[model samples]
Target: MTLNRPDVFGSISLMFWSIVIVVCIKYLGFITRADNDGEGGILALAHLTRSSLREGSRRYALVMILGVIGASLFYGDSLLTPSISVLSAVEGIEVAIPSLSHVVLELGVLIIVGLFVVQRHGTEKVGKSFGPIMIVWFVTLAAMGLTHIAEDPSILAALSPHYGMLFIAEHPFIAFVASGAIVLVITGTEALYADMGHLGRPAIATAWFGLVFPALTLNYLGQGAMILNHPETVSNPFFKMAPDWGQIPLVLLSTMATVIASQAVISGVYSVSRQAERLGYLPRLTVRQTSAHTGGQIYVPAVNWLVFAGVLALMLTFGESSRLATAYGVAVTATFILTTVLFCVYASSALGWKPWQVLLAGGLFGVIELAFFAANVTKVFHGGWLPILVALLLSTVMLTWQRGVVLVTARRTKLEGPLTEYLSSDAVVNVKRIPGSAVFLHPSKQTVPLALRENVHFNQVLHNNVVIVTTRSLNVPHVDDSERVTIDHLASEYDRITHVQLDYGFSDHQDVPAGLKVAAERHGVELDIENATYFISRITLRISDRPGMARWRKGIVRGLAQNAARPSDYFHLPIDRTVLMGAEVNF
Candidate 1:
């Protein structure tokens, strides 16, 4: 957008240095090292820090608030990335044929809908081609940039940090404003750490250092060189890098690259949403495994369609990339800031980094990201409010759900009472015992299953054999089978009533029936897998004069709980053999 040669050089320098400092140094060198059991991401980083920080400390509270804010902003990034990416790539049509500009939005929407539609089929087949396609895209980017740089070698001066400083010193306000747009260069940098669970750090670092980094550097330099040589091409310098005959092919390739990028972001939303659900920050939703061979290759239909609706609305409302760009930087830069803060916490608390090291590293990235965030803040009235609004809404939902769960769990624990006491109580001693086995799924093994209590109280009968299954979701990515199931005979007097704890990682599949079968086989727990009637507690939450949370927040939690997926479906239990016992609980 800057037509002046000096402005172009300064902007190029700003972007180049951002890549070096924010991405190459901070993320690749520092942030990626702070993994939660080989997993990386904002939430993973939070998980790592939460382990070291005292639970009720102020710092712990800060990390948690930042983590939720970071995660919420991620949804904003997920929504905007696809909209802006597809729109920007499709806008290339305007450069190739100006008369076709009108169809850009139509084409973009079509491509977006098609991309989301195919998500149900899983990315296994199409994902095989992503690496090759991206490699070609990067090569093309480098080649095109090399040609332009050769034409105007003066643009290479942008490699020095002085130009960026010079730009800021000369035009303070303009530089601050330009920082907002410049942040886009490092937009997808978070994914490097976020996807470490799926693709390890070594592979990601190698890919970055070997191919992605060099390609991006050359491409940015080439765009600057081309803009310098032909100032009139400033409006669409990327497409202008190609020859007239190659323009169409370049456009086609750009569209595919954006589609691949969008796919990654969409999948990330699903992964983080699942993580949130497991961590008790969100209600359970139906998760479908699209690839039987690959555990991470799963899809959430509700998230897929909800995001599509948002992306469609953004494309229709914004109408072009430039306008959408205003909304994009706020969420991304905010997330960058959150990640930096969390990393500093992890470094100091977990990694045992000295104060100076932590401060120096954190302050550098914090200032840089904060500047970008402040710059984007100026565009709030224009379109920046969209992401901030999205982040606020999602954060509220997460926090409310978490608070509601705590209150309800506490109340339910009192009502259910201790399992040991209940098993030895006079009521249980006089209860008529049935012949068949009954399995009850509860969140805690220490407490009596609510459904079990209800069944004995109202029906006046108890199963001869009872199994209490508690699925515990740990913060790690995967748990070994050796530690998966722990069998505890609650009482030798009532050996028929056994307690089984099934441990799972956040990424692990939550299949209760399958876990029960494994427990029966591996741990010698007694249970009829096919014939046992699985009992689930369907707790009905009602608002009361509770001292926990605000009335409005409680209502939101109730709505979310009401809309959550059925426990049987989520736990992969057989519907025909499952029974739900309803009970009222006030919060």
Candidate 2:
């Protein structure tokens, strides 16, 4: 009966599966990295934590602590993964020619430098070429694996539920540890979800299930076959599977792919940093335009230089892929687990699903993720300290920036009276009339910012029309221009306002004044950008011995603020029309 069955079914099934693999491969990596401000990675996860939970809620505090911790660990993963991915591929060269080992490290460094230098060109041009190159890479992997699979048909047995189950049963601890190593195969898979807004969910899902999964599975199985067939070659099964002549091209391709992975992460850092600044967790940094079309395609000079330095340090110190592997999984796995938890919360609150329903559905996924996380944690005593150290340093900086901004804002607000009080007071009423509308730019929603109060005491004169401009961001990117800016009347003469924020996906520049003008016109306000005066309060922070945070943290906070970009420039306020009220404030 089996022999009489048509071969057409098998042919059609193979064709269907092939299509699925191709689609998955195209978008899997990109999807895993998408997040706020057109960036994805640990920092994006941190932003998610702050944005999702209420400040006063117990869940907010808990999620914040957990998110930061997870984000810090993700930094570790970012540092180590490049080294592993590149070195493992380069090491394949050693199989073809043993003498290349002495020079491989130098080659690796060259590849990393070249990768970062080209980032200014924007990923769109390079990314277009990536799909084709990845196609070749996957095809090569599949071909190599197929050749070996022919030798021992039983090697396919590993795909069976029984082999995996039996392997775990026999050596649970070893299997757990091995799972960490294997998980590297799907390292950037989450980018598929994070980048959903960029590539769209259907594209990413199709890419993973179709092309990427099959190619990766084939390559991994080929490596497994090499290990099983020649037990002595277990030291580096990937290299053993490659033919002598194919090793050089494989090495080059692998190095290229690793560089691509690092580029994704570094770009992610820039996006997340900008988002954090907007969310009030980070100080604004000078974000330089890298591309004209993509608002998300920005180059943060400070972050870029810092990441380049860190990558170099990591390459120099680790020197080998095996050693770097120790640090790879811990951070990213932790982030994955944290994301699941956050997603559960988001599903419940934002999606308006039943709490029990979300908990049940998300909880299953969480359990599997945590198991993987635990495996990564087991690797901590090894060279994992590398990523942990990097993450801790980053988290410290993030937390300090957040705390310092809060304290400084609070101190500034203390000096100002309520809007109703200020408008009714003799001080505002007695002021000389000015020609145009006077807009006061305050940092918070409270009565008066301390910097504004200092400026008011010195200037003493109020303008004819008073407008307090406050900018707000929605969780999603790219709001309609009509909804971008909203003006609400708070009291008789007092106005409360908000803005609809728009960000182009990671490849365009943001023009705040132009955007505001467009939005205002759409909302029926004749905004005269040419004649309007923009007022900004510049706070100069003074270091004090007042007890608040650790001395080191205080120093870090001061340095971050000092190095931050001036608000006028960051917000794209017109230099020709803007005036700064500089005042010294204590934190």
Candidate 3:
């Protein structure tokens, strides 16, 4: 009854079966309404839905909400998983050598710190070796569990639906609480999808079903056997399954596996943050390119440091994995439910399903997920607040960044206008004597920006030819240089204004000046980057005593904004060409 890969008669047959199993598992992981097992999990899904919405599609709102919830849960899960996985492994040290119990927590903290420190070096160099190491880890777990299963075949009974269900039904309250702990077993499954694009669906599926899943199942069953035989050891059953001689090695191996799991979650946060920036939910940050070829391979220093600090704080506060479990399950469960809702919307819009059909399927899944969410919610008083607080803090930053962009865009739209107005004005009478044409590059769709009024009044002399360039995004993946720019004459003297819009794909970087140059030449205008002055309105946030968001969340948003890198750097505009107009506003 051990959940091992079925034996094939020959190599050809084995290959055939492997493909079949991997393909099936891949689809299961993809369509199960769960987050992508690879780097594209709930957060990636949220970005997709948000981008779709921004493109004038309102149908995906519900789906986006669900995705947000699911991603938020994952954040919570991130906080908890490291604690549990690392702590559980450390506890093994205590079981192996009882005298080491006093130092177990300290050792676990040190290990967690070391793991965080190495993250600056991209995972790619070390990750290539992860698969092979994990294979060994899985095999060891399976082999160890198999030894116990041989002694009592009945250990397989734990796999039955009845056991889990009955355990819940009889001790409803404790089971509800314990479910938070039990869910940790499958906590990393979603990582399979989040990291899907990196490992590829086929490889992850092969790794999971072929090795990880069976090993995990066997280990759980073996642990169950130990609990049944020596009920006294139920407090920590996993370690009890190991023999006296093998305990130390098992502890070492388990710690390694947990470290790998933590690494995956940390990396996932980095990937999601980058995606968020592209989709406009996050502010422009310093993104260090990790790999020349892989666009997705990036390092955000702030995020890395933040997560490291949080993980350290978690290790210090919780001190044990069990307490951290309460916080972990709630966030992950919430994320799962959110993803289901988003998937339903995607199925209807993208897949062209009928509304009722989407609702029916979504509703069914939602009920099951909500139940799990509710079960986790009951643990709020225990220690669930930690992950929620983290997610709330993150969500505030995301929302604030989004709001700031919108406000800036709105203010720009109000200030700029067609070049013809300046040409007709008597104030530009002196411009005829000026040497060269003045080009103002404003980041907006409107010909005039609100903040430009003061600049216009101060610089009364208008250029013989004025160009107001603005960039626009298209739904298509890319716009050729020839099609990137467009020009329209405004109704003012010899003054003329041009709007330049650049259509960049989500996968592409935004290069404003380069795009502007290409666009101007394509539209029959002479390219002059040197003559162009980039007018960027820098919004200085004022925190009013008037109530807005919760005090803590508002503080988080301000901190995030304060740390946000300037947009000029993000768009690769030269500092010499930039003009900073500062204005304070309340959110």
Question: 1-587 in candidate 3: lDDT tens per residue?
Answer: 12121110121122222222222332344453333323467666665555445455565454554555465556666666776788888888878888989998899889888887777676675576566777778888888788877876776655544555554455577555555544554456555556554445566666667776677767766655555556677676666677888888888988998889887887667767666776677776677655534444556787778777777788888888777765666777677666666666556555667988887767765664566678778888888887788777666566666665665455444444444464456654443334443445455543454334445566644444455666664434356666666666554313454545566643446788787677566665544666766766666665555454555555655666777887788777778867776656564
lDDT of 2 by residue, 227-269 (tens): 6567677676665677777777777776666666666666556
Number of the predicted model whose TM-score against the real structure is largest: 1
Please say which candidate is ahead in lDDT: 1 or 2.
1
| Alpha-carbon TM-score of each model against the true structure | 0.94, 0.79, 0.76
TM for candidate 3 is 0.76
The whole-model lDDT of each prediction reads: 0.86, 0.61, 0.62
Per-residue lDDT value at 97 in model 1 = 83
Highest lDDT against the true fold, candidate: 1
Model 3 misplacement above 4 A: 1-39, 43-70, 157-177, 190-193, 196-203, 225-235, 349-364, 393-397, 400-408, 417-442, 449-456, 460-535, 541-560, 573-587
- Pick the winner on lDDT between candidates 1 and 3: 1
Candidate 1, superposed: residue stretches over 4 Å from native? 1-6, 289-297, 473-484, 493-495, 503-510, 518-524
CA shift of 144, model 2, Å: 1.7
Per-residue lDDT, model 3, residue 368, is: 48
Better of 2 and 3 by lDDT: 3
lDDT of 1 by residue, 452-533 (tens): 9999999999888889988887756578778899888875634588888998865677888888888889888878888999
Error of 2 at 582 (Å): 1.5
